[model samples]
Target: MMKFFSPDMKCSALVILMINSFCVFSQIPHKFLYVVGCFENGTTEVQYEYDAEEMLYMDFDRDEVVYTVPTFLVDDPSKLFENLHIYLDAKKAKRSCKAIVVLCKEEEEDPTEESDPPESIIYPSEEVELGVENSLICFVNHFYPPEIKVTWTRNGLPVSEGASLSRYYPNNDQTFHQLSTLTFTPREGDIYSCTVEHMALDRPQTRIWEPDFSHDSSVGPDVYCGVGLAVGLLGVAAGTFLIVKGHHGR
Candidate 1:
């Protein structure tokens, strides 16, 4: 059964519904709602979702409720919490979680079903320019289980410094996504790659990224214009020489 902290924040309470409660096959679509949080470094994030879609979340830093889906509305989102005393309880929950108290447990997936593999891509944060400090972002999406390892490499050598991984984020389809970033100064002919390992895949997935410096794109038009001018001058000279030869023969 789904468990949550009691309203008083002193004990754990079981919610009415269990994860399997919605597992039955039915003609009608089932709507599932969940509220989860992460407490780290004295910070808290309480996210609420319905049908795997983000509805709203409480921003503890801002002490405000932020709406994610525009279609989901309420007269006053804050009013729902004004009298509930949830802010204090959420804080208490965070403390309890840091203390190793289990406020909630993750539901395991069915063993018979196959795991979904994730797809990944590597890209720069902005337009790539050699000799400039920049960051490379490796985005992995549409994976189940929310557990994965990401590693970075430069020129086939393992890279560790200046690399960071973000927390997994849920997608509308219930899958998860994550990002890893590496900071470095771009240099010509430098090759970079991000490799991902997940239980769903038979082997690790690797994506490569490199700076492009074969030629300057900005000089392309000028090069073509110069070539055309040189050809035109040669044609003009050939035509004048033929005219003079014809006149001498006359």
Candidate 2:
């Protein structure tokens, strides 16, 4: 079913902007599902309607179809699954139905002395300083083969460009363990995550970071008092030595 379609090569920026406000209907349509845009807001204005001449997005407020997605056939199962996931996630978050989240699959790593797979790193996350831009991230991977692809993504979207990866092989073992490093910049309220998508797992495994949740900046005052006491004792010793030397001279 056509969720929406454009007509007469006319770009209606105003219509598109207006549709974005409805917040219930998805502008996305596919052959497998209706993928209707809806919310718990008690109105379903962005309903699906198909016309033979062209597919269109109708504005119930203006009583006219103003936009459309496209007309195409995509049969890949992975693509279909990704689409479904995006739609479901959008619905759950109450975000725009037109929002799309790209799905990523990790490449497997196999390493050997003669032929090392992609080097990968798996480590427990460290704590991120609050608002300091350093967030702790966790990753798990043992890439077996060489020339593996490594990427970091949040919410199934690419985060940054540069990533460093390494590999290690044991003396007796034949397979190599891979290591990968990516940025773990933490947001204030949101968590930073490291995901490993080895060819082994059907989906990537993600670990949420634990920031240092402590708000106390000062916790120790006894140590300061101890230092002050030591200084006082040293002063007393110096004064006694001076007094004894003066008395002996007299």
Candidate 3:
């Protein structure tokens, strides 16, 4: 006569004892039976189990041990252990390993196909002072599944030093984005590129950026202004020549 008690509940001792008694004689084989009662939107799980070592019925969950049967009531504990071993072997043969089940609100759908390739952009740091330490940023966005490989190169040679990649972040529409930056000093004619590889792309996507002295702010605006002045002078000279020739003919 095994006694069962709810370790957390004193008043539930009688209920646990009755349930354990029912479980002992229940025709359903313990090994094949799995009674899982879920509550609170599946956050709470209650599992009923049969313990072969103590030859007792038990119930437990994540928080605390719910109930256990006392040993005195179980007759022929050795026979119970034998039956449990046989049941375990049969279960292993049937499932081969653990099995999992997931419930979702939506209907189950097939696995997604490969998504579109990621969009990439490369740009130098805004501070354009020459001979200063700066970084080239590679922004890759709007990619699915979040797994990607980013690489950097300078002048067609692989650049590993001073290169870093940020963790993937989720986008508003459920896509993903990541950034890779390469730190380097700006120099004339240095070409840098960032390459991105993903499962959706047959070939790697690369974006290139280079420092151009012609586009330097200190010189670029002055050159454009000088060219505009020179054009204006030419136009004035042509107008004066035409007027003087008309006066001489008159």
lDDT of each: 0.58, 0.32, 0.50
Model 2, 1-250: lDDT tens per residue? 1113223211111011112222226675422222232312222222222221112223444544333334354334234234334333423433442231110001112111122223223332333355554422222223332224445665556666445654221111222333455555545555345565554445656554444456444522433343354334333322110000011111
The C-alpha stretches of model 2 lying farther than 4 A from their native spots are 1-127, 135-143, 146-148, 167-172, 210-212, 215-250
Number of residue pairs clashing in candidate 1, backbone atoms closer than 3 angstroms, sequence gap of 3 or more or interchain: 0
Could you tell me the lDDT of residue 132 within candidate 2?
A: 55
Predicted candidate 1 versus true structure: per-residue lDDT over 115-233, tens digit per residue:
46999877777556678898888878777546689999999999999999975665544456777889989897789999999988999999998886666778556545544543343
The numbered model that scores best in lDDT is 1
Q: Alpha-carbon error at 66 in model 3, in Å?
A: 36
Which model scores highest in TM-score?
Answer: 1
Kindly state the number of residue pairs that clash in model 2. Answer: 30
TM-score attained by model 3? 0.44
| Candidate 3 C-alpha error for residue 138, in Å | 0.1
Per-prediction TM-score to the true structure, in the order listed: 0.53, 0.30, 0.44
Candidate 2: worst-modelled 10 consecutive residues by lDDT: 239-248
What would the per-residue lDDT of candidate 3 be over residues 6-116, giving only the tens digit for each residue?
Answer: 222111001111133334487864432222222112222222334322122222322223233344765444454454443343333223211211221111232233354
Is 1 or 3 the stronger prediction by lDDT? 1
Worst 10-residue stretch by lDDT in candidate 3? 239-248
- Error of model 1, residue 249, in angstroms: 92
2 against 3, candidate with superior lDDT: 3
